[model samples]
Target chain A: MNVKAMQKKWLELGVEVEETEYAKTGYDFSLTLPAEKVHALAEVMLADGFYLVFVTAVHALPAIEVVYQFALASSPRCRVMARTAVRADGTVPTISDIYQGANWHEREARDFYGVVFAGHPNLVPLILAEEDVDLKPLLKEEKNLKDISALRHLPAEAEPKEEKAPAAAKKEPAATDKKAAKPQASN
Target chain B: MNVDVIEDERQHQFVLNMGPQHPSTHGVLRVLLKMEGEYVLDPQPVLGYVHRCHEKIGEYKPARAFMPNTARMDYLGALIYNQGYAMLLERAAGIEVPRRAEYIRVITSELNRIQSHLLWYGAYLLDLGAFTPIMYAFDDREHILDTLEDICGSRLTYCYCRVGGVCKDIDDKFIERTRAFIERLRGRLPMYEKLVNGNIIVQKRMKSVGNYTPELCARYGVTGPLLRAAGVEYDLRKAEPYSVYSEFDFEVPTEQQGDAWAAFNVRYREIEQSLRIVEQALDKLPEGEVMEAKVPKKLRLPQGDYNCSVEAPRGELSYYLVSDGSDIPYRIKVRTPSYSNLSVVPEVCKGMMIADVVTSMGALDLVIPEIDR
Candidate 1:
């Protein structure tokens, strides 16, 4: 599914979806939702034949921002990035039940940033030792941390109205379009 | 061969630690195995023995300064990691690389990929109790390392690629040598086919072992040859084209058997496909400067999440870079493919024989540092 249809579907789940330029940003759909709807969105993505790309978190001003990326495994490739800001206690509901691949990613996020995946089964330290569970080494210092708004790449007013023009396009998608124009193997 | 023996009559399972030291486990990975006689009940991989916290290091330095660290994770496919990180920064900062530079990047990276696969082929065969193939595979790989070292000036971990483009340009001698190397590898392929792939014993060992379905790969997010072996024709180069890969015409090899043998064949055929890419890239090598002319000295990326996925030899290697409008990155997430690829082993090896577990894990072509990082 393209961004427009997915945006409508995500909106039905009561979240605002931002359609980003595939040319400018690596992802086509960007959305931020509450922690509860992550599993729902993951189910929809799994139904759409998308695979979990990676799940990571960043330490920002308000809270720890957890980001999940999914990409369509089939043709007419599209990437979707869904983010959720953790609550005061840095807890978000786990989607490991939906995507088994998310289990390790969730653990890695927990190991690095201390963002708890509330219901993750076997949520032990993945890339860290058991002794260093509270290390949270990737978290930024207070002076170095930036506000979430300052880290935003897409402004609300700067949404691409002209999608067809090549000047604003990034190299990868344009290259993919060129390849898609060619005759590919039926398999 | 130490196994836990319980005195209780009902207890049938024994625990076995596979590595963090064993030679076959490959590079400091430990798999805790629950076994009943020769059959494995559960194989849980315990990681982090080699964890260097590469992400934390990515935050402290300038974006360009962390180039060498990317090479260290997947040392075999180092250039591809460097390419991914460079492309992520280029896309984030809107830097344009010259056509010549892109061609050079593809050519060198493909050569690097072929060598990586060759090493995996040799090492995997060795793990499966064959020692002669490693000699042949390393003989071919040496030619690749020599050609690359002529330009990149390194044998293993090459930080040859820079942020905007590559650090050095390829000379005419390099092209001539690479063409000769391709021809030599093509000539040697038939001998390898006869000695390895055509051997009945090898086929018997791998055929129908470690069987998995396409659904299992999708559920676990497996990519590269393992996914292709299960009949998913998804290669990052072809599916999501990056660099000058669009210019090359090649096939994404697939096998429907979905077993260790099929995965082996898929990777073997990829060597031919990669040869086609390198030949095309060298033929289309353009004339110009190798590096971007106006790359800023201080590489400050526009604040946001920027990511690039490149087809590493093992699988899709992606770098998710987040900048805070400063020279230093806010957070850099290296999503190595082996992390996902290795996660599927427990499921695939659930009811498999203890001996066949070596074949199955070797077929995945894991680089442990890449997983631990």
Candidate 2:
């Protein structure tokens, strides 16, 4: 399978980024989406033979950024990061039913960041005790927020805007533009 | 001696707990076993016994300060963890690592893989009721550890890898000793084959004991030997080709049978392949500074996210770092391989004899600390 060609499909589906920042940063490809579309994206990725590497959440305050690392186990590596934001309800649709491996990763994300996966077979706390679930060990206070990219003395890439407060980066609902640009008969 | 009492006893279902207090389960792990007579119906793993707040520490400390802590996550394969975190920071920050530094990283990390496999072999045998092989395995492991001790000083949980390069250079003595150790172990390989692998008892016990198919591997997100044992030739060394791995020519050993026996053979063959990588690295050992120049004492990755993955001894050891433009990271997630490898227990270990559960778990070669972290 042509691993690189899959990005065009994702773009056609409307998850748009001009190109992955892998050469600039380390991630191969990053698709930032809302919680609702993530499960559908996972279904598409899984059908394409991509395996779920990890599911983790980065607390950027007000909202939590959930990152899913998926990789294809075929020739020509195609690694992509599927990210989405979640708020107070902390619920994202579960893909554990599709990929059995997501079962523990989703639980671990919940254990640390309290970003719950809706319809997860078992959403119990993992790697932490039951009482400590409310602590949400990974959430940092505002005063302690330090820009590690600056401290390390390295150049930073443009970050995707937090969904709750969006400004830069191409706006979503971008599928039609890419689709229209392609030959209409190809559909 | 009433027949009614016997009937009641026979029909009763029971639950057994294995080691939150520790033994046989590997590290401080606990398994909640549901059983019907002598057969296990389900095995639920309870983690967090050794959770040392690793992610919290990563966020609180500067990137360089957190180097030593990476070694703490997967103590058995500390160098791989060190390599993963260091590489993650380097990639995120666009730090250029020297060619020599990359070669050094590969050599040391491969050595770590062999040492890890040695212990896994011995421990697996021990789990299968053979105690003698461990003594023999450790005897060989001690030699490699001694050679590693000469370079980094610590025999285990090495804190030697830095962001752009290793913490220290490999001395001539360390190189000579490692070469000699490799030859010594190579000569001793057949003896191990005879003593452990060739033994009739081992073959009978391991073969067809716990079948994990390729489809099963995908569903469970199993990687490394477990995936390879099921005949999927996807070693990160070959597949992703990070660092200087692509430069090395080696075969990924795979097995058609997805059972404990296949895992045993794959891991054994992997040790030889690791030895080959060590040899190639030694021959091509370049002359240059070990540390990358202009690397600041403190490391702050740019305000973005980065992921670095290394094929650790057990499976993929991935580190994800999210920076908030501060000295401390916003979030740091350590994706240990054992967590996913061990998670398949409740599914596959179910409906097997309790003794076979031990066999299957041993085949997984899990380091409990890795899972807990």
Candidate 3:
């Protein structure tokens, strides 16, 4: 399949192809499709005789990139990678309807990154505990440090030190006289 | 007399829990079998007991670090997993290995193949209530392991193959030892045939039992000897040749029966072919730099997804890696052959006896850790 024909096919389906890069390896093209058109794009790929290799997600700084790889079984050498980025908040369409093999991979993705695939039949935890599920472990660590700093600012550290307390006891009378003299200044 | 009459009229179907501990179940696998007087009814396999979450660990480790970890998943065919991971990294990074390194890889892989088949042959016969064959198979396997261990550091989990090439080169003495072992194996093949292949009882138990058609084989993504037994000539070494397999001349053995007997025969013949491959690789061993140019201290692959498949003893083992041009992979998915091959057991074991279920499952070579991982 030529790039022009594939691009036309995607355009006909109302899927906007953001970019297409040719791979130096055996794979011909790498297509970046919109998030909404993932299911439709997968349907087209399957119809064009592509086998689902696997699905994976990458945690980019601001957004999460979900990549689905497929290849023609007869021509196993040629590969096509379709990527779509969803917000880090976790919202994307499911491709299980197109390829049954995506069932386990999607469940795994959901377990690790908290990516929610809409219309997935079974969305329960596959590899991790449901009760302890945390979407952001790194963010949790940052919040923990801020909580510790706030606790330290509560005037609890104003108490006298042990050696200073002994010295202050001897000078208590003089300190009181000085306080009385500097009352206006203290106020 | 009245009690006896009532007992005779009672229902006989009962449930039996086989393993999670049973020796026959192989590793931490548990099968819930519904039985009706020695015949099985709907054996539901309960997995996850041995799941170590290898993929999760691989996600954190660097691409090169995954070489050692690959062996732990399928301990029986550890070197093949090691080779598969190393080969994928080599291909992804476009590292060129020398001709001698390729030959050595072939030699070690073939030896690993023999060891795997011997273990499979022994264990399969043991499922049929024969114990002596396993001992015989182990005797031969021990020699192969000893030879491999001498060249590589470890015995079972051989972290031998590096990213670009082998970790160390094998001297002429190692090559001579391997050649002698091949000759010894050729002489012992007939002995194995006489011991188990020609046994009347073994034939009765294996022949015409647990037959899987070629169409079902492909539908379930079965490969290696099991697919070949069903008459699909789809060995990755031939179909998608890798690691100097194209230069070597050997046959991909196939059996038309597609039964337990056929699977057994195919594996038996494959051992011979593997031996032939090792001999050819040894004879035509080239001399050159074993390792490729030194890779970076901190290796990072380009942002891409790569899927590579290799022929393991059980079937086709595929590793799908998604790299984001980072030290750690974004995702690592292992499509283990045992997982797919074992999934079709319920479909095949529906009408078979309890004994036949064990036979069929064993013939499939259900490595529970590989499946559960």
- TM-score for chain A of every candidate model? 0.80, 0.73, 0.62
In the range B46-155, model 3's lDDT, one tens digit per residue, is 66677677877787778898887899889889889988888877766667778888889889988998999999889888878999999989989998998999999888
What TM-score does chain B alone reach in each candidate, compared with the true chain B?
Answer: 0.97, 0.96, 0.95
lDDT of 2 at B367: 85
Whole-model Cα lDDT per candidate?
0.83, 0.78, 0.70
What are the runs in model 2 whose C-alpha is more than 4 Å off? A144-187, B1-11
Task: Score chain A of model 3 by TM-score against the reference chain A.
Answer: 0.62
Q: Largest lDDT belongs to which candidate?
A: 1
| Model 3 regions more than 4 Å off | A1-187, B1-14, B36-38
lDDT of 2 by residue, A1-187 (tens): 6645777778766674334566555556777676777877887887787877888876543355677888776556677877765634557788898888899998888777677788888888888898776767776566764322222212234353332222222232232332121111100
Comparison by TM-score, 1 against 2, better one: 1
Best by DockQ: 1
Off by over 4 Å in 1: A1-4, A154-187, B1-9
Worst 10 residues of 1 chain B by lDDT: B1-10
lDDT of 1 by residue, A71-123 (tens): 87766678878887775455788888888888899988888877788888887
Per-prediction interface RMSD in Å:
1.2, 3.6, 11.6
What DockQ do the predictions score, one after another? 0.48, 0.33, 0.03
Q: Who is ahead in TM-score, 2 or 3?
A: 2
lDDT of 3 by residue, A1-187 (tens): 5546766887787654433222223234556665788899888876665556556665532345566766543322445666666533356788876665566557656665567787887766544445535532212122222111111111223442222222111211122231122101000
Instruction: Kindly report the docking quality category of candidate 3.
Output: incorrect
TM-score of chain A, model number 2: 0.73
Tens digit of per-residue lDDT, candidate 2, span B128-159: 88999899889999988888888887989898
